[model samples]
Target: MKMKKLKYLSCCFAFGSLLLSPVFAQNPPESQADPQAQSSSSENSHPHGKAYRHKMAREMHEKMQRLMDKQDEELKKLANEMNKAPKDQKLDKVVTLLNTLVNQRIQMHEEMKAMHHKMMGNHKEHHE
Candidate 1:
């Protein structure tokens, strides 16, 4: 009976060790993991990455606002020139209006380029 009790005690001890070992497994000692890896891991993990994205978006938003302001100015100038153009000078008016159209097209193309650049930056961040 004493031998059986000894066996039971040893078994219980083994089981206890097995259960408690996981506590240590749950967290590594600070020195064990590479510091740079830890920092980079934290940076990519949800909150920090999300904050980075938000910051990028804010900057891009400001740039978009500036571009819009420029577009508005161009639009106002185009409108003014068209309004000032006379119907009596039809050929001259046509030429001026066509030139204005070309300028507006160029402005739109620049805006598109800016938008595309911002989109590429956003995509690169996502992949990283």
Candidate 2:
């Protein structure tokens, strides 16, 4: 009976230690995570002021709209110039207008991309 009781206690002790092993284990190294992923996680854990973010987004939209409207006006001016050109020069004028329009469009696209990048960077910073 004594031997049986001692064996039972030792078995219980082993099982209890097994159950609690995780509680004593070292935490996984944070360096294992991608730096950007860790940074984004930390940023997400902290929230920006809702009103401030909204206001910034609204301003950005307004600025983009203004830029688009200016582009439209420039395109219309190009169209007028092409229309007014002499018949002999019409093809050349059209080519010039098209090139100008393409360049303007490319510039606009680059500006918009830059704006988007800036906004996202600001948003991440503000979140923290």
Highest lDDT: which candidate? 2
Candidate 2, residue 110: lDDT:
83
Best by TM-score: 2
lDDT of 1 by residue, 1-117 (tens): 677556655644554454345322334467635435544554566565757656876787787678667756865675566458664443344444445545755675676568658
Estimate, for each residue in 1-128, the C-alpha lDDT of model 2 and write its tens digit: 67755665564455445434552154436873343454555454556545565687798889878987897797688778867987656556666666665586678668777876886788666665
Provide TM-scores for the models: 0.44, 0.58
Give the lDDT of residue 115 in candidate 2. 74
lDDT of each: 0.57, 0.65
RMSD of 1: 33.1
Worst 10 residues of 1 by lDDT: 19-28
The parts of candidate 1 lying over 4 Å away from their true place are 1-47, 89-102, 110-128
